[model samples]
Target: MVKFRYFPDMKDNNIRNFCIIAHIDHGKSTLADRLLEYTGTLQAFQMKEQILDDMDLERERGITIKSHPIQILYKADHKTTYTLNLIDTPGHVDFSYEVSRSLAACEGALLLVDASQGVEAQTVSNTYLALENDLAIIPVINKVDLPGAQVESVKHQLVDLTGCEEDDIILTSAKTGKGIPELLQAIITRIPPPERDFNKAARALIFDSVFDNYRGAIPYVRVFEGRIEPGQKMKSFATRHVYEITEVGKFLFKKIPTQELKAGDVGYIVAQIKNIRDLKVGDTITTLENEAKSPLKGYKEMKPMVFSGLYPVNSDDYEELRQSIEKLQLNDASLRYEPETSEALGFGFRCGFLGLLHLEIVQERLEREFDQNLITTIPNVEYHVTDRQGNLFIVDTPSKMPDMGDIEMIEEPYVKAEIITPPEFIGNLMTLTQEKRATYVNTHYLDPSKVQLIYEIPLSEIIYDFYDKLKTVSRGYASLDYEFIGYKPSKLVKMDILINNEPVDALSLIIHQDQAYYQGRRLVQKLRSLIPRHLFEVPIQAAIGNKVIARENVKALRKNVTAKCYGGDITRKRKLLEKQKEGKKRMKQVGRVQVPQEAFLAVLQLGDEK
Candidate 1:
């Protein structure tokens, strides 16, 4: 085992670092609020629901977008006060990286499950992640006060899933603050303290960070060995940029300055680094004087799994959109945007995201936070294309794909999807999966009423509207989680959209051969409804290379006319009608069909066919 410098002044037994993990809407944030009140960390007047969730977006959406860590002073049964660092994590699968980093910063985790909802897909996924980190998991059933809650049933499920005793599962109603004190006491007594090594160099793991206009980049770190204080010169292991720490503070809804953050403690460090890009999350910070021999493990650069193009509704906002995305990327490292132009949409950025939810959140933030009107293209999954020369290439956009003759094979990403639902929805769920080309893995019974189904499906099949359909078919009882397994060979084709026989590159898509026909027909049908009628009939077609497979027509508005009189009058009317016909032909050649913003978004929600 590697040894590190330990701080003799601070005792490791006094610190308890742990994070709370749960499914969305499982009262995880509510429980965090209750814990703060119970521990007297925040006064009753200062207490707010989801105190850790400070972002306006998070509050509005009723979810945590970023993980927050706070320090609380708790008095144990032995009459001794201990410092507990509680990190509140986002429950969404899109933010799983945040959860993983939070777990890596702690020695224990609070596995909070909703009593009413029982064990959900996210809860199970998070539990396994915690176990992988070797964290001591404390299973707690939340929202027991709700009328529909089945505490015993949930308790049995927890016991079976966690292999912990039924009696060990603590039940709490976050709204009423019941069982909070017991939960707090259990945290102090049951969770083991972090290990310390004072003899080695000072090292801290930077799990999360944010930009501060007044001070600069402030990184929230968990000190695993040694200590950090004001005036200490620290350098990031990954970036190698060094800066002197100006101040260290604990997050108490706001920043609260502390003397020093020692081993096993979590707090924020304000350095002179101005650019947020320099302060990388998941990087280790060690003293410049005696740097740690090795950085802490599990540091990885975040890569986006989904790619989409964001064009400004008004072309003038292109620069504004670019600047806005740059500022947003400071807060969200997962976001990747590069300047791109489309033939139909003009100037925009091709942005990459972690998942569909991530893509939506970024788009929503761009619109709401930056006040920019944007047009987003359909989200696409990264595909692997192998050429005839045995070279592999990643295709993120349809236009980037190589020629069919040059490409030896094409592979699309697949994920291991886990769905937890009521037994009644099994047949419907199966049908939905089968339609999406999902292969069965296995099924397990959580209890007499609930079932967990596993399947392997292509990532592209669900990227658009799978979750919405699942919730509809399952009657809102089903919850799902998925992780990318790998890429598999697929028979895929590029489906293109044409307006007036001219192919629109922005509207083209690379889809499976089996889905090409249906997708093509649906897109054309939707486009015909969105594109306004021109002077002449406009034909919208879906084509594969040179062959057209589906077509729809937007009929032109007719103009009322009256002609014919006497024999000489009829000849004059004929000449007039000929002139009108020539004019109409000229108008048809010059006039361009305008497709509205709704037309582009309409094709995104072609849900699973019933």
Candidate 2:
């Protein structure tokens, strides 16, 4: 057993630090609202649903993409007053990094499960993450008020997964405010306080942050072994940047100014630091006078898994788009973008994201928040290319692939996909995976009716429409979670789209050889429908190097003759028609076909969407 020495400046008994982890639409934010109301942190009249999810996009989508930490004062029936710091985390796998950071700052986690949905993919994913963090997990079944609750079945699942007693599971309906008081009491009595050493140097962990135009970058931190105040000077272990603290506060729905935040406390700090990049999440904070020997462990930075190009609809707004992305990146560190130019689309930025949802969120934010019309390219996974000379480099865009003569081999990313669904759907799901080149892994029965299927699949195959197909085959019951499993050598070819004999570099794609012919045919057929008729018949071709695998033609617009022909000579009318034909031929030779932006977008979804 291990023992902890309390920081001399603060006591641990009155504080409880914990976070709520759950699957998407699993009542996490709703439960947080009840906790705040039960503790009188916010009055019922002043409370809004999902108040912690401040982003408009999150509210619109009914999902939490970011984690927000808030402090509540709960007075128990035993006349014991406690300070509860609750961090609310997002449920989607795309935001797993945020969940991990939130777990790192807490002593315990509320393992919330939907009473109806029971255990989903993200539920298992987050529970394992919490276990890895060594957090004390409290199993709680939420939304018991729903008619389809299936309370007993969910309870059994929870008990079996957690290895906890049935009596330990708490049932609550966040919408109706039932069981809120008991939940508060459990948090204070069950969750342990942060451990600290009185003689050790001051240390704080920065778990999350937000950008403020007026206040700059405000970091939410958990004090591990020290106290921080408005006037204290500190240094970040990651950035090594030192600054004198300008303010210290705790978030109670909003920032509430506080005199000091000691060990076992969760609060925000304003260090007058304008640059958000300096406030790296997972970085340790120590006093400048006596810097800590090393930063906290497990501080790996998040790397983007998917990449795409974002260009302005109007080329003139390129600078505006660049500035908007810069401001957005200040708050979202996972977004990676740099300047890139395209032959077909002109200037844009190649942006990297965690997953498809992340890419959608960033694109939505850009269009809705920044009010700019934009065009996004097809998302691509990073590929590792090895040359004949044994030099390895990464290619994010298909058009950037090295020449075949110089390339030794191409390696594509693969993922270990975990899928859980009813056993009845297993047959169909297995068939779907085989079509996508999925390597079968072991399957286990979660229960009599539920099964967990594992497979190793190419990231490229799933990046586009595998999830949609899986859902269709499983009848919307299957849930998926995946992790990168490195790269393997594959027979991949670069497929380019050519319009009127000219290749559109922006429309290039990397695809497996087996599906190349079918996909290429489908792409050209879709393009032929989307591209408008030009002056001359325009040919749309999908090519692999010099070989054209699929081709379609967009018929030229017909020009009718309406000239006056005084019933005199048929020769005069023939000459007029010939002149018109010659004119059209000359125009076709001089005029270039312009492909609309939507045509490009349509090609991206050709295989995915109906």
Candidate 3:
């Protein structure tokens, strides 16, 4: 395979590569849209709302799914000289891996916070990550034009949280382009130029990547020091794999090939690389001869936090689902998986994800891209079990549950949660938290009316539809932030489902005993709706260590099929078979038809159902 590189002759001091980081719906995409317009990089007619978030799901969901880099010419001081590479990143916690990669690629970050919401959980988490990465932070208080926007108070919160000076906060609304010019000026003045030694061997950081049909895998990189050009050989400092660049391109609104790229420029390279697994985010790429003293520290790959199985509604579409997953993984490095064989569900994948949103995004993309319907099991977190013999096993799927006697101790991860809510809801919020196996930590009054409630909760509890429920109870008035706080010993059990004395792997779950009654009943109810009316009664049971807490039955389906296939209706039997296959495909075959992802999710809505 051949490789190519870019070596630009221009000075590096005039260019800037930065990213906008914010909480979900806090206007990161909006600000990016305005920046493109302000710089004339995009014409008014060419502009679409959230254009950088080009994915249909992303645009519709209004959250960036991946980091996108775009370069524009900024004319200041009578010179159209500076090349600004703006990376718009996902703001939700599930995409923190993408956020970290974007931060690593830039010398600075624009920390956009909503003026009305103040510093949200994601805002504080992302800001702290940026600061830890040693990037120069420019705090921008957005949404100033809104009626409830409290720009001044938000500035105070920014200072209090980040230690950034209150005067450093820039008030702006990306909607009307108010203060956008000053915000651009701040980018030029506050963010430093990329520091590099051109004489040294080339070294750049792979902060983002995408798959293109024309050019296999394109890794977006920041040339921190040195230069590169087409046909030059390079190697990943961490992976020790070498490749020659086939194409080097600058992201000018769209990725455009350039003959050369110099130190401090943010662009992408199409190498002899096909699989994205080789070019990891945060990995350092450098010239073969002059490698870094050591690969950039802290380059560990992201570990998936949630696991589930994805099977096709049509058994024959299994390969198509696999292909779709491969395509999706090309762009999403945070998604991990391996071919998994299930006795009941047939061929599928034991897929891993960063969180619930990550899982949902991948599933949606699979269905959209491959045009194949899928039957997915409820997502579960991995657990570490050590037997009395000191053997350790990481249990990702409930089907892999260890023998009851072999288990000695089980450890599960916990998280520190910070919830900001109105004072009036404090009592209900406390009650809700306590019910989720949460222990109160501390509470602070942000002002006279708003309060910050801190709790230490098991990561397992928050992993499953907890945020959605939390939001529901808080009436969208609460903001939650949490980080993994290591593992703690807890009373955990595998709640198994037996269909006619046979254990159904897809129906098992790892849950705390205290929650087994509520969760078990919920799961049983979900299964009752999910399992189609089949021949004979099928029992949906949630059992903890052989003890059944809840049971529901899906009665034998009457009138599921026509009694006769009439003349000219021969096609009807075939059609019915096709429809039955399609409907059954949606139902997971866990000894029988398991309804679908929607039904599994619906079980959580029993409270609303009441």
Candidate 4:
């Protein structure tokens, strides 16, 4: 028999690796806190709101930004013990890729459904993802303490929707800790143990990773088989790079180095790996002896779904912004970038992100972490353009689009969306969706007073602040979920911006021909307000195929800099210019005015007027 290594062989069958999956605001984080409290992992005085959501942005936005894994000890019989590895995942569509990776690291999942909201689109989608991963689903109907909770009804919905037995459903309020102990027991009973062939070479999966200034890149891993110790030689399955494990440790809400880690435990490896690209989530790590045939499969690198350009508000801060991006990239592998230069905006970066929230998170982090200001371009979707001769190019920025004569076919992505809302707002919701070029697929009554409306809509239609608009139209009663279906032929035209009748290459866009008129007018109106007044009046025009669909004028500046500078005043003006330059150092200069990136983002919602 092949020698199998074991480390800290603390009871094999008493450990559980699981994640809590739920829709946004369904109390996943809260449930995690309650679990920590009940398990004595946290003292009552030490408990803070949403401790797992450690990032400031997450707490402010009331969303989980990253997947957090915590280990807790629980007891059953007089001598029985278990180590519960609880992975708390982000509850947003933008981070679904992260969710999938987190799910892959576990053998089971706790599907948390809000008792009052029942089954939402995200709930169904995440549950389906978990099922697809073959995870043992432990359905937990949470928020039962809420006044509007319909626990029994939600239990039935879980049974009907997921095909899980009604008796399998566990009613728990992560808030009041009601049914928490039972939920814990159910986890111990229902979840299966990790299967591993200790005889084989040590193999593990990296589900999470972060950059540590002191130790380099620390990858959070789950050992599938065999044992791993500090100083063990290993190679990454994806990058094919070899490294020595500098340290092996477990997360005690924070990192605590342990001597060794074994199968079924979630731990971190301090490898000399410095770059994020070297450590991929879902990539396998294995020993050289009896090396595995291949690394673990099913690891798909994340692709950026949205494109935008970021420029420093001040030319001086350009390098600072670039440095900030590099540091951010150290931790965020999902962000993609390429350096871009514009005649009007100078040097900037064409950055790509998973989605709007991902884009906003990066921007916010840059400002908060680096304390630098930037100017960002409007968010846009990628399009495939083909020339008459069949040459094809994927264009992300409208400024990079080829001339009209060079393109014959344009293709854009489309998505299938399911929106659930109250019956009273069906007409208004339908009208809003229709105006956004959504085609009705089907509608079903989820309950007597609630409805699920299915629509096949162009991804471009909803990519720009559509969720915020949907919430406004539904009065916060609607929940939406969408997935990319495929690409389709679109009558796309490049809308050009004209300042004083001269086309400004910086403000071009690719839009569908059918909606050019309204979109063009709206964009021009938005630019009129966003563009700062200069020495000359600027005429903003949106055009499609040689036709101007909308026109707006930015009136000339009435006053700008002070005309006269006396002795003390001159010093003050110099100081003011220096301060302005310092401020500009954080911003990107677009045209004459130094514009901040937040201003570019603020204009994104200009078209959502009532």
Best by lDDT: 1
Q: How many pairs collide in each candidate, listed in order?
A: 9, 0, 16, 9
What does candidate 3's lDDT look like per residue over 1-610, in tens digits?
4333343444657778789988889999999999999989999899989989888998889888888889878887766467788988888887776688789888899999999888877887888889888999999999999999987778777887778888788989999999899999999999988886777767788888888777777788888777777788888876688888877878877777787667778888878687788878888888765656666655767788888889876789888888888888888777898988776678888999888888888888887887878888767788889988999989888778787678899888788998888888898888778778898999887665467888999877787667877788889978888877788888888888765445667667787868778877876776676666774556777777668788888776545564566567578878876776666535434445544456544534544542
Ranked candidates (TM-score, high to low)? 1, 2, 4, 3
Best by TM-score: 1
Candidate 1 residue-pair clash tally: 9
RMSD of 4: 7.8
Candidate 2: pairs in clash: none
lDDT, model 1: 0.86
lDDT of 2 by residue, 1-610 (tens): 2122222333558788899998888999999998988788888689898889989988999999888888787778757677788999888887787788789899999999989888877888888889989999999999999998888888878877788898999999999988887788788778887775544677888888888888888888988876776677889988888999888877767777777777777888888888888887788898775457887776777788999999998999999999999999888877899999998999999999999999999999999889989999999999999999999989999878988668899999999988989989999999989988999998977666568789999998887888898889888889998888899999998999999889998888898888899888888888888888976788899998889999999998876664577688798889888888898788776778898887777656865654
Q: CA lDDT, every prediction?
A: 0.86, 0.85, 0.80, 0.81
Clashing pairs in 4: 312-587, 312-588, 313-587, 313-588, 314-584, 314-587, 374-597, 375-597, 376-597
lDDT of 4 by residue, 94-206 (tens): 88878888998899999999999888888878987898899999999998889998887787778777788988888898878999989989889999978755676788888
Please rank every candidate by lDDT, starting with the best. Answer: 1, 2, 4, 3
C-alpha RMSD (angstroms) for model 1:
3.7
